[model samples]
Target: MNEGLKVFLAVADERSFTRAASKLHMTQPAVSQHIRSLELDLGAHLIERNNRMIRLTRAGEIVDRHARQIVQTEEQMRRLVHDLASTIFGALHIGASYSIGEYILPVMLADFSKKHPGVDPHIEIGNTHSIASMVASRTLDVGLVEGSYSPNEVETEVLGADELILVARNGHPLVRDSFVTIAEAEKECWIVREEGSGTREFSDRFLEDHHISPERTMTFSSTQAIKEAVRSGLGISVLSALTLQMELELGVLQQIRLEGLPITRQLFIVTQPSAFQPKVVSAFSDFAKEHFSDLTQTRTPVHRTSIDET
Candidate 1:
């Protein structure tokens, strides 16, 4: 029945037996046979036949809807069964934006692997917009992104809060003082994340709020590239302080507090609200919340500058 439904869907979508047969990698005779068997089982013709065109009958439309639901449910059932057997033993598909994926998730994933040796984790890294789209479309089991998502089909939870700081190479002119006003910060050249990045989105919103724009800016897709560029005195950038912890320790980069700028943003874990979540995903989500909660709680606040300081 599943196979029959698959064949039916292909034919219905293509509106041609020959095309459906090619798509399904089946002979035209086999495709026709499946449709015939389906009609026999239901005791009704499913497709309206014509020499040049094929259309779905009223019954076919209903069956097509049911077929899609059936397929989706079956896949969900398989995932659930695999999860129940031992969530720690299945593959977990996760997507994340560049900053979180590169700077934060590695430590979390490493800890997860050590704790759950049976679970295999595969990660896909992209921009926040792409990661959110993947989660909404069920292409990814889960995603970690910075900032908020507006997609109605996806559910989101805040994983942690991070501050974006204006950073520069050690001894750079911008680092002369512990704090600078937004107007002063905007006068410097900037190395910024590319568009569509959650980091970039937050940075843009913060700048717009302060009525300041960078005099010059260079865009980089990778945070590593941006960091290195800033280290080389190419320009300054606004980035999550967590990403620069090692750089700050090594004296490679210095954080510059900026007045009248809201540098804080939330990290989110997003997934399709209606999709069946595998147990592996559920367990990972729990682990992330537990570990990240402790980390965020114990962390000291970054250099704070009041908006009135400007």
Candidate 2:
């Protein structure tokens, strides 16, 4: 496939031997050699070269269509062979958003690896939008995200429910309060996840629905950083309750509830409906459903405690 389409597509699209050679990472003479060989085999003048420019002749146009179809068919065939070999031993490439990757997938993956030692897992972490795009482009076998997506090209399965909770450093002035109204919480400094993050997206919607806006906000890329910043009393943030479990248990942070904001998001597993997923991916997907389905079943209440309780 590479030899067949390499020179033809490059020359046809670029219309210049010099440019096509550069695109194909081959010398100009080498590109000309391949084209000449193709012409000899086909017995046709496929291209007209003139003054540093090239155009496809009638025969060239006819062959280009067949060349493209042949290339596509070859790709499909390769995928099929790879999938077959992967049933016994294959790699699964999974893309996940920040929260799911950091707080959830490690445990799920650990269990899956123990069960299926023959499968190799490659994980990529990004924001929801980035992961979704990667799955759509076939760069990833599947994606797990913590928000709703409306992509027509992909199929989404709801895996579980995750809730966002407002948390602050222990012993903060608000920790002793039984309830913090949205308006009152908005007056405090806030540390938030970066834009495009699933937690941040939910936080923004939570704030909007509650009719409250933070007076001061700081953004951090990782949940660990945000947790550390909030632990030191830098600010408060709305984050996944799962992300703050250790802190909550250690009395480093306290969850504060606000009125009128649901603060919950549905976790989803997204994949291209038309794409073929390898056997390893299917195994992992089944493993995920078996072990992690409980995480999505019901929303848990935020636990609260004072610094003195520690």
Best-fitting candidate, measured by TM-score? 1
Tens-digit lDDT string for candidate 2 (84-166): 76543555778999888988899888877887777667899999888988887666778999876776867888777766777
Error of 1 at 50 (Å): 35
Q: Give the Cα error of residue 286 in candidate 1, in Å.
A: 0.7
lDDT of 1 by residue, 60-111 (tens): 9999989877865665576688876765566677999998899879999999
Candidate 1 off by > 4 Å? 1-75, 85-87, 181-183, 298-301, 307-310
Candidate 2 wrongly placed segments (more than 4 Å): 1-88, 295-310
In every candidate, how many clashes are there?
A: 0, 2
| Every candidate's lDDT | 0.83, 0.77
Candidate No. with top lDDT: 1
Task: List the candidates' TM-scores in order.
Answer: 0.73, 0.70
